[model samples]
Target chain A: MIDKQVRTVAEALEGLQDGAAIMISGFGEAGVPAELIDGVVAQGACDLTIISNNAGTGDVGIAALIGAGRVRKVICSYPRMVGSRHFEERYRAGELELELVPQGNLAARIQAAGSGLGAIFTPTGYGTKLAEGKETREIDGRQYVLEYPIQADVALVKAYKADRWGNLVYRKAARNFGPIMAMAGKTTIVQVEDIDPLGTLDPETVVTPGIFVDRIVRIADAGKAAA
Target chain B: MSAADTIQRLDKQQLARRVARDIPEGAYVNLGIGLPTQVANYLDTAGDYFLHSENGILGMGPAPDEDHIDWDLINAGKQPVTLLNGGCFFHHGDSFSMMRGGHIDICVMGAYQVSTRGDLANWHTGDPDAIPAVGGAMDLAIGAKQVFVMMNLLTKTGESKLVEHCTYPLTGLGCVSRIYSELGVIDLGPDGAKVVEMVDNLTLEHLREMTGVDLTMAQ
Candidate 1:
């Protein structure tokens, strides 16, 4: 049988090692794979480079991984929020590194990595200090800065549902970066709420095809856990 | 000091209305956090306008009542908001593509300081102790068709925010075109910052003296 389903979070994150670049999909707490993140924490992978939208909030989820001294750097758009004191304190103290990419550029760069593109010219950071060291070109009088792809060794994504074939469906706006991350990562692990039988998921509704997915771990009592 | 000096300047709501007046009809706009977000509430009702929130929301409506609040449906600033009739949600990547692809007509943003030459310095205050959060300000600054800064003319410490040169790290250069402040509204052009309007209570001299930048009164 061709099953992408993994028995536990450990099996889903088997090859994640030290110094690996991990892309986590989320917009705040919306699409984060908590069980996969917890597996990373339990595995104690160090010197990790985390890529996401915002730095994890509070001492849970991403913050817990950072708090445990696992993450050495973070590449994100917004790294500071209400419960992001862990990142703030460490960053201010020079204990952690942060690369702040604009939201658009961040997404485009990740997409470029997945699509086998080298670099993209974006007008987002043109004529700014962020563009200072970057190569820029004027296209018909408008300037565009070159941004390179942001690839990852592993991607941890959360999906609303998945099939035995690993076709994924996302819930509402929580879908955020899950699809893109799945594409950009060398190994993609998905934590899903429900696993439908093979051929049950509609082809049009499948946000992420099983081809991109390496493992699917179903969190027990997903309804209660998500609540 | 005259009693006129005691009169309060434009509050958050008044300043928002002033900024809203300049937005043309049939436009797609993105409003930044804080003061800029307020501008949406005062937009002209007749226009077929669409609001884009970077957190996967497009065609955003006014803030929802407390009873109807949905935490899942929130704006870029993470505040609960209602979706308009035509509103739809998409992935974050698509939301940003709309922002950075020049689809947005205007972006009204809150700034710490804006230079006479339209240089913006809002993401960071240059304070070492402050936690830096760049967010989507950089993309909005350079990608929108026109960038409008909505902020207080002076900082809380009585320092002018409209300066000849910005001291803080810039979000973008030569991006800002118009400025809406409590003291007055100004247009940033090749010549410099020109005072387009002033509160009736304040004089040109008072504005000049406070700003320290040469302010040409619009004819």
Candidate 2:
């Protein structure tokens, strides 16, 4: 029997270490694995490097973790938001480092890491400050900037449904970074609203396959809680 | 009344409607956050065009009513939005691929500054105290087939945003195709900035003095 289901958020985050590179999946409040993030906060891992689309919105989830002084750096496309005071304060106080990449380049770089690519040449950042330190080449007539993959030691993902084998499906826009992060993380932990029996989810609708996900924690009320 | 006394600029809604008029029917468009988002309102009555939100939605609709708000469904700006019939969602990788792959027909963005050569500078002001965030600005600037900018022609201090060259950090080079501003509409290309229209009672000479860049009248 191949089962990857875990009973609690603590068990799902077991063996986490300090100074780890973690990819927290979400775009704004949608699809954020808040429970797992809270577990990381409770687990007390320090010096974490987080990669996400946004830094954090309020004093919750990623914001709470950063507020707890757990994160040392953030690599994301957009970190400035309405309630992102913690990230701003930490950044201004010289306590946190930021690497701001354009959104397309950020997604492509993460995809490249999961696909086992050395690097990608994207037209998004060409002729801009984001491409300043990188190598550039003109393929045909269009210029492209070389961007490297962003790999993580662990990825925390939120999905709508999953099976014991860990095949996952997500809800609407909440699916933002879950699938890609699942592949890029060496040990991917997923918090799903429901864990179905074997062969329950139609294979055609599965977004992330079992091979990419390592552990699944069922948080039945996560959707309402996040709302 | 004197011509100067009669001069009037378009309001933000009027400017948005002006930009909306230029979008061809059935074009796939992405509107950047802030002022450019207003374009969607005018677009509703125009024709059938698909709205693309960078967070992974196509066929995106207007803001949902309070009762229908879903936290799981939101726009790139993180505002609650409705998904129209035939709408679909994907992950970040596929969403950005649709942008960088040149599948987006047009993108309307708000600008801090734009050069006569079509260079864009909206991501940052180089302020030392600011925490810079780029988001998807660069991608939409360069990736879309036609890039249209929506902004006020002048800063609050009365300086022109359309310049000979942008002083701020660049987002993309030679990417903008047109600019819709409070004062008028201008098209950018290899030739130079050409005036397509101007507000009533606004003269070419006064427009020239305000812009600081040489302008040619469109034939």
Candidate 3:
């Protein structure tokens, strides 16, 4: 196990390869791992498939990858709001692929993948254009739609604090996609603002246990740092 | 109704009943996670008007059976929601496309502010410590053919939420076509906004007095 913490975003991204299906945790800008996203951009990783809720505007998060010309497919629900003009141009020019998911279903898919469930049935958008070509089954005289699993090679999550054992605790909306993706990824990396000693974290507060986290990277306070 | 008789006196639930009256037979709608979600209780969706919860379940009729709620099948806000007969679940990716891709017919949502230009501001109150979660509001606001807003005219601070321009963050720009308030229904148009319907006893002056922006009623 890589029990070490990386010093730089570049060092933190050393394990990610091109074409990797990476799941990023965030809702708008709240829970996004700003440092990790900056690292992905700085590392110049390309041809990536990013799974996220919404692309934090073009200058941040998955949008940076979209800007770096590194992203291939985006499995997200909303792109136009955040993706910059460059992203829009790419999407319209066929430079990028978009896989839209409902916000709730996106969370569930991530959770479902994490929970080891093969699939689930929801009637969210059925009998409309969204149901095009999907396999439909009748359960109890009502039609339920089936959605498959969502797994990825790596997942980047931001947590407020983490213990040396890699247990994580998130503050606010940052917690939404983090824990779910932790279980869904082959290698889950956490970027946290604070790192504490092992056993220091209250057991009840452990949002993502060490078993789900493969690595830890601590971020020095970016806002207060001297230029 | 004139702009004068905009909002007389009504509560959010009362407004929900007015919104419920508009549910057409067999139309599909996704009630946004917050106050707009209360509309589900007033509509008769037993067999029609499929209610969709952004968290990925349809055939939605009302809140989950209080006696048998399932946390796993909750909506975007993690509130327990129930499925009507024939309801199913799918990958969230597909469901969002249905939203952004413009497959759903209507989406009832809550707004912090709606501009005369029809811009929608919701999901953020500018509190840095507050969670910035816009689950499916923007997608639903723009994707659905018709967007209905259910909101209080003023914030707790007593500021008018409807404005000439949005001072807060926006979920979508110029996406709303009409609005239903405790006062009445105001249709967004090219020349600012016009009051199309009002509560039985209010007037345009009363609406302007209680609103954050200038008011106009359709002649």
Runs in model 2 lying further than 4 Å from the true structure:
A222-227, B44-46
Candidate that would win on DockQ: 2
Which one wins by TM-score: 2 or 3? Answer: 2
lDDT (tens digit, per residue) of candidate 1 on A89-201? 77877889989898889999999998899999998877666677999899999888999999999999998899978799987667888998999999999999889998888
Evaluate model 3 with DockQ and give the value: 0.07
- Deviation in Å, model 1, residue A113 alpha carbon: 0.6
Q: What is the lDDT of residue A187 in candidate 2?
A: 96
**Prediction 1 TM-score vs. true:** 0.92
> Which residue pairs clash in candidate 1?
none
Worst 10 residues of 1 chain A by lDDT: A218-227
Q: What are the per-residue Cα lDDT tens digits for candidate 3 across B1-219?
A: 555444365688898998888878787788876687888778864447777655445675455556665434456655555666677654344466667667888888888888988888775676654324445665576678788888777667767878998877676667787788877888885688889888777777877887857778877
Q: Is the docking of candidate 2 incorrect, acceptable, medium or high quality?
A: medium
Q: By DockQ, is 2 or 3 better?
A: 2
Q: Least accurate stretch of 10 residues (summed lDDT) in model 2 chain A?
A: A218-227
Q: A134-162 in candidate 3: lDDT tens per residue?
A: 88788787555688878899899887788
Candidates, DockQ: 0.53, 0.76, 0.07
**lDDT at position A53, candidate 3:** 81
